[model samples]
Target chain A: MIDNTMNPFLIFISACLINNILLIKFLGLCSFFGLSSSIKNSVGMSLAVIFVTIMATVVSWIIFHLVLVPLNLVFLRTATFILTIATLVQIEEMFIKKYLPPLYKAMGIYLPLITTNCAILAVAFLNIDYNLNLLNSIAHGFGVGVGYTLAIILFAGLRERLMTAPIPKALQGYPVAFFLASLMSLAFLGFKGLFGL
Target chain B: MSKSNKPGISAPGTAAFLYGVLKGNPVLVLMIGLCPVLAVSTSIFNAVGMSIAVAFVLIGSNVIISLVRKRTPGEIRIPVFIIIISTFVTIVDYVIRAYSPELYRQLGVFIPLIVVNCIVIGRGEAFAYKNTVKLSFLDGIGTSIGFFIVLFVIGLLRQLFGKGELLGKVIFSKPALIMILPPGGFITIGVLMGILTYYNLKKSKV
Candidate 1:
């Protein structure tokens, strides 16, 4: 377990770089590979992911620490947290549509997809598993979002360039994209010892 | 490739089973269950363990969903599907923890993350809900077999290359560390897909 006094900034940076949720930890990759075809759409997806992950982490933290632990219902964590996230996505959809129409138009469809994205749930479980404080949990969640954003954006850029390259018939679409992901993961691994966390 | 046999028109058990193994392979073809494919494919043992666990969940969820397909309201079907799926996932999680503590420790959160695995819920929603119990069960088995095969191959390569061993027996003096890392998983799957595509294209042309 990390010390309780560990700096939130360090947690955030480490999550974003060294322990990148997508490249390093290999979470939320379905959407990462699926939605990284374009920069604009990937940015939208990342923003929605950022919002949903932070909210889900904070909410799951409170539920785990205050409710499940006390009631000895930790077993219900998987079902309850998923249901909560699903409901949260629904409510978030409605709320965005009603008050923030423009924002809703931008990220409305992507919001529902967030429920299935493993990164949110992964972050929620990780926060508890690491025994992080409330602030650290939020920071970690935010950092994961940023890391995901970084990965997707960079991947989108590479893919955009790959569009023009004369690729072989066999490795045209997904295979090539995955190779790109492997290289990116390789690059991200270099950050492992930077902070020594 | 028979003209007379079309999906939903004829209910062939073998057909459905074989379809999942090749045509509708969850990992290589459908690309649904990449999370477990990437995270747990570090070794052949982990690959088999994760496959069995997922296979159990997939079979259970498919059977139950097919049984209650008529009764479940359309509006609430997704949640109902989720509840059933998570119940099975929880069962597998506890069973693993009690019987195999070391495997459970290695899998850690991934056991629970099975709840969100697209393949399980994908089968529940796509095939089981509309198909009969027998067909759904067969589909579950076939899909899991496909998943297991791909995972095993990837794990085999990774373990053999990464650690210079197979199931803890050293095969080489120098192991490539990248083969077991996250990047190795992506590269292996990517190259495998490329080979599959190559063969698929060749077959199509012929």
Candidate 2:
């Protein structure tokens, strides 16, 4: 078990930089690579992820601590949490489509895709694995979302510039994108000893 | 587009199997379900463990989803598939924990994250949902082998360079420790992908 007494601020920084969900941990790469081709799409997807991940952390934490634990049904965590996230994404999409029409138009397409994003599920699992309380879990979730946004936005910007650069046909598309990610990942490694995390 | 009229075998079945292993490899060609590939591939041991676990879940879910495809309602097929896939993942999670605590610890949350792996669910929706049980089984095997092949190669390279060893045997004294780090994973995979694309492009031209 991790030390629960660690400050939430440190947790935020650690998750955001030291252990960035996309560049460092490699979670959510499908969307990281897919939606990151354009800055507009990446921003929309990141906004949706930020909304969904925090909500998921809150709900899953509550369920695990209150329901799954008391009922001794901890074995069902995987299935239960996935079902909850799937349902939540659906409800959130519907709610947004109804109330926030403009917001829905902006990020509506990415909601359904978020259901299978490993980052959201990984966040929920990490919250439980690290033994964080509700406040810390929320902080961690937000930090991870911000981390994802930062990486994807930066990546999209680079990819935009890459589109016009001369390149070998073999390395034209994803290969170059991956090499770019490798460089960014190497750069992000500089954050490892930050705050002695 | 060649159709097989040979007795006791079908062309589509062979095509399905070959597609996963070569044409539509989950890792190399399609680039889906890459989280585990990059995360646990620092060592061949962890890579093999992850491959086996994912293979089991993929095969199990594929077979079961193929079996129930006809009866499943079209509107809710995605949820149904998720449930089936998660069940197998949960089972694999405990089995690994009970049998090999070391592997379980090394794999950690990745075992559970397999539930969200795009390959398993993608296969269930794309191939298994419309194919016969036997063909789905073959597809599962072929896809697993493809996944295993890429994973094994990455693991081998990373282990050999990172630790100057292979499967716990020291091959050399000096090692590039960065090969085992996160950046190493990205760089190795990037180079590998570039090589694959180069070959494919050459093949097509020829």
Top candidate on DockQ is 1
TM-score of each: 0.97, 0.96
List fnat per candidate, in order: 0.77, 0.71
Cα lDDT tens digits for candidate 2, B1-206: 01122123333777778777887788888888888899999998998999999999999999999999999999999899999999999999999999999999999999999999999988898778888888889889888989999999999999999999865678978999888888889888989999998998899899
Candidate 2: pairs in clash: none
lDDT of 2 at A148: 94
Candidate 1, residues B37-134, lDDT tens digits: the string is: 99999988899999999999999999999999999989999999989998999899999999999889878889999999989988888889989999
Q: What is the lDDT of residue A143 in candidate 1?
A: 92
> What DockQ results for candidate 1?
0.60
lDDT of 2 at A46: 95
How accurate locally is residue B24 in candidate 2, as Cα lDDT from 0 to 100? 79
Q: Going through the candidates in order, what is the number of backbone clashes in each? A: 0, 0
Best by TM-score: 1
